[model samples]
Target chain A: MTARLRVVSGLLILAATVPFASWWEAGLVRHVLGHVPLLVAAGALLAPRGGRPVGQPTAIAAVLVAAFCIAFWMIPRWLDAAVNSPAVDAAKMASLVLLAGVPVGWAWPRLAPLARGFVLAQLASMFGILGAVWLAAPVRLCNNYLVDEQTVLGRIALAVAVAMVVAGLVAALAGPGITRARPAA
Target chain B: MRSGGLALVAAVVAAGAGLLWWGTEGLSVFTAETARREAVALAPRVLPDITLQDEAGATITLDALRGKVVLADFIYTRCPTICTVQGSDFEQARAAIRAAGLGDDIALVSISFDPEHDGPEELAFYASRFGGADDIWHFARAPSRADTGALLRAAEVIVLPDGIGGFIHNSAIHVIDPQGRLVRILDDDAWREALVLAQALADDTAAAAPVAGGAGT
Candidate 1:
């Protein structure tokens, strides 16, 4: 399973870096969509299964790193730089994969249920707030993207935020028993 | 172990803050466009002396326009949307400058980045449509693609093909002083303020001159 997961993760990264990178050059929405796969691949590669228990401090540090990475990349100037400059683009991919994706994946299983819930809630709120700001901004936030594209990306972000919130609530209510039992069965 | 963890966390937080501070230019500029505007405003940049042909096919260089404050905007003749608004804004600005009798002190220029399609004739039509007058208002295009790109880069104007024969670009009134340095960039809607600033700069140039008419030829 681990070997297969690694292969899948590798393929995901390849798809995002090659085709999605070229495809997203023009539109902010497409650019953001392209980031999703990179983030997922990064997490999938480092996903916990039967590893030694991670220390609480390590988990907290990882979470902080991941959060900072995400926030850093989301800044408009940095986002524009990543889009325009090939060097910055490579750095963005590396940081998102290593700092954000890997850290989040490594920290996930180590975090307490309450801490996990808090992370999810924070993510949801952050997305919603960013979405609202993008939608309402009178001027284009990124120089490379059109105002219309920004609005479309904003709507997509809001949808994703809503979906995440719903998923978190469902997971919380359903408990771990159903999910854990299914894999065992 | 707990103290070690705290130290690590503190270090990460400090690093993140530092990166953020640097990335946002000390937290003063939030967007790339804003950063460009702020940087230009802080230190005015001398524009490139690219060869351009006015609507009448006469060759002109930014260096030649050193005595008069120039309000320049980038546009393509075929631009269907924002360029139209820019044209109208320029017309209003031209009228306001003339009314204020600063036409000699201020010159309005629209530079076409799409030089492939916007030749002398096309520019002439665009100028006519906006009531662009000779000398006071000029619709100009670079003679070559390379020169056009250079001017756009010098002015920090980012232009991307819309993939539909149109172009997507950020529009603003770039105010050039009497010394040919790009001193200010105003929003497309702020042409009035741009004109006012240009008049002030022109006045300052005239005042600083050793002799009357020494600034402009």
Candidate 2:
């Protein structure tokens, strides 16, 4: 699909998810799983393309910021605050869409193969660790979510993490020749 | 799309599909029945010790009720809807406790989130109307708006002011064990279940105290 189509699709998904995000159960599902990917897709579509690639250092930093942003949102306190406070909720949206998603989309492809693999490994580990914690926790992690919902989320997260790890491994084995970042135009 | 982009799209699709299933049908590995039971079992969180005023202008601290299984509910005197049902359910639980001769071991507290309209006199009148016996049940109001909000926040109670004059709040009986930790919160009143759980908690506390005393010696 063209960049415009990808952006439109992302926006549409976002618009649809917003209504359900007001609910207790559905809200969490959308916030954690829905908005993150949708924003990333839209951001990727809109990223600076075909220009001189960002420096390896800048790209690495952006990837770190994006990963940190994702991890920050997964904390129980942040989840609780997002549900209760409107300002925090707004911040979650803005930070995910504008700061994390846009930068990661713009920077990830520009980084060297090794750097890209490192970022992927970091993301996979983060998701895997977080998923295990959420799943094994005996008590409810977030005040806003039920134990069952948390478990479901954890399972999904772990599954996605596994998929990401497998994909990363495949790319790594395929070697740098095929996966190398194109030189700056 | 390139192979890499295709893989990315697939990942997104998978995540989205999983989320959609959960958001819509709540289909999870754990059955709904199993989840509910697990939720109830994982209780006894240390409740915050917030003090408010009872109907007689006397200060009531949650810490004071540490030795008693306190069945608490949130309500405002001005509520026209579900609070009435909550009041009835609480009354049933109170009666059940009294009948079981655990009245002294268990206390019922109705906390008013709307301090503006549910002061001492208002709570007193509301309590009496709901069959709130003087010794068994006490109705109280939060000392201030900020204090009330804080108390509610600590309890994880969501209270939203309805566009009307009243508030929409979670209507449930919070069962605080003898240790002051809220052991269970039942929306159904579940008089028998509440009594059984409260008795178990009381028994657990009784069993642990002697061990502690022996250790101290």
Candidate 3:
């Protein structure tokens, strides 16, 4: 798809998620997993083509920042706060969609095969771990969410983890042409 | 440069493992002790000696229960959610205490937030359904809506309209010391701790009193 189309699609999703942001399940689906990747798609499309490839240091910083932002939102306290406080919720939506996604999109294409795989693997591991925890926890972690809702979220996390793994494997076995020859700086 | 990048990747992996451990433990790093302390810290400066009416329309105050350790919880008779689970937990705790013969020293009270609906009759019905006894497990209500609101605020219980004219509130058990001081609000998971703490508080009060010297003094 064209860059403009990707941006438009991202914008459409951002708009669609606003209504469901108040609900816990919708918040996870639309904001955490949905808009995050959609916004990344837009960012990748909009990335400047004329510039030299993003350096290793900058790529690392981008991934780190994106990872941290995503991880912070995954926290039960932050998730509860977002549900209780409108300002915090808005911050969650904005930071995840804008701050996390754009940098990841810009840096991902510039990263080496090993670094890319590492990032994907990290996300997959996180989902799997958190999924297992939420599913197995006997007590409710979030004050606003019910035990059943938490379990449903755990299932979603596991499903996402599996999908991430499958996607990573597919990319790894795509072809020899998938490999980047440039040495990562 | 590539090696440094790989090292960074290694660091991220290590961090991921650490985080995974923490998450799998259900944020266990924030121990139950910490939750107890924080909940206690959030109580109001002074627990008001507010009047509460039992299901039979009998008026009682916190001061009346001062000599005993009170385990309090907020609930509405019509609540179809967490209150049920909380009530069940309270039942188990009650049984545990009674089985240990600590029933007289520790009193369990469920304060209704919906005073408009959960009047004496409704509360009585709820108490009966939940197997609450008038002498042991008392179901009470605030004398007025305003009083109920104040009590809810003082207890740090957040109540919101569920859009169906019902309310959503925290599931917690407030522990009041023998001195009538609001001490800790144990989370639902801490029911076992509540029994232990209540017993301890009662024992402390009993231990502090000079039974023989009272008449001479």
Identify the leading candidate in terms of lDDT. 1
- Residues B1-217, candidate 2, lDDT per residue (tens digit)? 3555445545644554554354323443232223322344485467556778999989988898878888888888888887887788778877887788887788888899988877898988888877754777888877889888887876677665555666655566778888787767775456567778788888888888899989585
Give a tens-digit lDDT track for model 3, residues B1-217: 7777667766765675575455434454343224434656565245777899998889878888878888898898898877888888888878887888887898889999888888899988888777855566788999688898788766656566665777766667788888888888777668899889888889988877876448654
Better of 1 and 2 by lDDT: 1
**Model 3 per-residue lDDT tens digits across residues A1-185:** 67677667766766666555654333444444565455445444444443676468668867776777677667766666676678987887777766677767778778877888788798899999988998998876665555566678789999999999998778767845534555555
Write down the TM-score of every candidate: 0.88, 0.56, 0.68
Between candidates 1 and 2, which one is better according to TM-score? 1
Using DockQ as the measure, the top candidate is 1
True contacts kept of each: 0.64, 0.00, 0.05
Q: Which stretches of candidate 3 lie over 4 Å from their true place?
A: A1-20, A23-54, A177-185, B1-52, B59-68, B76-106, B113-117, B129-137, B142-172, B178-181, B187-196, B202-217
- From the highest lDDT down, the ranking of the candidates is 1, 3, 2
lDDT of 2 by residue, A1-185 (tens): 67677667757755654444565324456567766666556555555555675456566656655655655566555666677778877777677766667777788778886777777787788779878977898865555556666788889889989999898778767756653556756
Candidate 1 residues A109-179, lDDT tens each? Answer: 78887788888899899989989999999998888887888899889889989999999889877777656
DockQ of each two-chain model: 0.57, 0.04, 0.22
Candidate 3 docking category? incorrect
Candidate 3 chain A minimal-lDDT segment of 10 residues: A23-32
Looking at candidate 1 chain A, the ten consecutive residues that score lowest on lDDT are A35-44
